[model samples]
Target: MPKPGKHINHKGRNRRFTNPEELEEERRKEEEAKRWRQKRGEVSSEEEEEEDDEASGGSDSEDESSDDEEGKKAKGVSNLIEIENPNRVQKKNKKLTTLTVDVPPEKPQLSRREREEIEKQRAQAHYQKLHAEGKTDQARADLARLAIIKQQREEAQKRREADKKAKEDAVKAKTAQTQKALGKK
Candidate 1:
């Protein structure tokens, strides 16, 4: 009993086992295709074997030929295309492994405490540098001291000028008094 709407062949089981002659014809067609490929310079093992046999001037035995034919049939159309092992190919267009000095290596995974310590050290160094330049708030006392020293220097300069003017005035007065006394005498 055949399934509904299914095509049945009362002669054979399925399309694969249909006609032995049809299978043989299909095998012949495959051989013809192989011959055409050979003409186009695509060589297979079977073709190579036939060439070797011809070169050696010896005929292959029936069993060996049949085995070779069976092997070719087993390989089928899949073997027609040449496939290269991807690993075997050295790709010129592949992205190059560039070793650049500019790119820093990955930092080692540090603990939170260690990272914070490093950050603190860097900040301390930065602040210390700024403090040395009198740029940080911590250097305000030093700046104030500098300002005081400058003010003191300016006061000392003024005092020196005043003392110099007084000495000059006294000398002028004494000279004028002596001249007047000499004239009067």
Candidate 2:
């Protein structure tokens, strides 16, 4: 049975996206918000830690002795690896660094042009850095042109040197002819 105004059967769109990446991103955002709340003292650290443990599928009470042994072994291995490679420690720290910066007082509002200029400068700098690394589209496109220009310059330099040598050889021949004529006289 259905109402007169409503259809008996209907197709409906999904409420949530089927994309796994989007779902993972949403979860990450929620975790970041929770961390921020904990930092602001709005949520208790103990509760958040418990939630984190549950999310990680780890238990505090069960296998406590086994967890301790595994933790110690992992710590020992990590220490050895870090001692062998200092760069790895820096990289691990970089991933773990939290973006929990202290809020600064609001400054005077910038004009639209000023904001645009700052954005432009930042973009230019980013492009320049990428260009230096030969990672930008423009840099890739310019590589052939740069090589051609370099070849042309080298050819021009070689031509100039050849012309200079020819002139010097002609001058030497002229000097020898004049000296021979004087000797004959």
Candidate 3:
């Protein structure tokens, strides 16, 4: 029976392309194609080889000696030019670049007015606090005295009401006796 989707077996039992050499060659070709794509994108082993080649080729000893000789010749030409222009005066720049900040001296002593005002305010606040404490103590004492007076007045008023009630009861009993005598007549 033929399987679907390009004859690769679902059970993986049948190998149609039977040569092992052809299979290995096909795998090698696939890998080589992948590497070639990576190299074309500058991201593979061949690209790294080219970079190593360029770095090794650019720094030969003959190129280094020629660069050193050119540098020495340029320095010698500058020195010769400066020696020939002997009368050319190098002007000194008069512009100030660095800044010097002037700091004020510290004062250890307070002014007389400030010291006097501070002392005066301190004394005033102290006296005011003492006066307030004295007033508070006096107010508490007055409240205690007033409470005693109110209690005494309440006791006296109660006693007066009791005495008045007793006097009314005595008058009522006396009137009942007068009524009895008048009824007997």
Which candidate number maximizes lDDT? 1
Alpha-carbon runs more than 4 Å astray in model 3: 1-135
Q: Give each model's whole-structure lDDT.
A: 0.79, 0.76, 0.70
Instruction: Highest TM-score: give the candidate number.
Output: 1
Colliding pairs, model 1: none
TM of each candidate vs. truth = 0.37, 0.33, 0.28
Clashing pairs in 3: none
* Local error of candidate 2 at residue 170 (angstroms): 0.5
Worst 10 residues of 1 by lDDT: 68-77
Mind giving the per-residue lDDT tens digits that candidate 1 earns over 1-185?
77867975578654555588898999899779877887875667757677557665556544565676665533456667877787895856644566456878898999999999999999999999999998887699889989999999999999999999999999999888999989963
TM for candidate 2 is 0.33
lDDT of 3 by residue, 43-149 (tens): 44444444445666745645654554455324236656655477888897665655345757777798999999989999988877865675666656877898999
- Model 2, runs deviating above 4 Å: 1-125
Encode model 2's per-residue lDDT on 1-185: one tens digit a residue: 77787874455754755799988999999889878985765665355456756766666634553454454423236656644555654434444357545768689899999999999999999999999999988898899789999999999999999999999999999999999989963
Our tally of clashes for model 1 stands at 0
Error of 2 at 25 (Å): 81
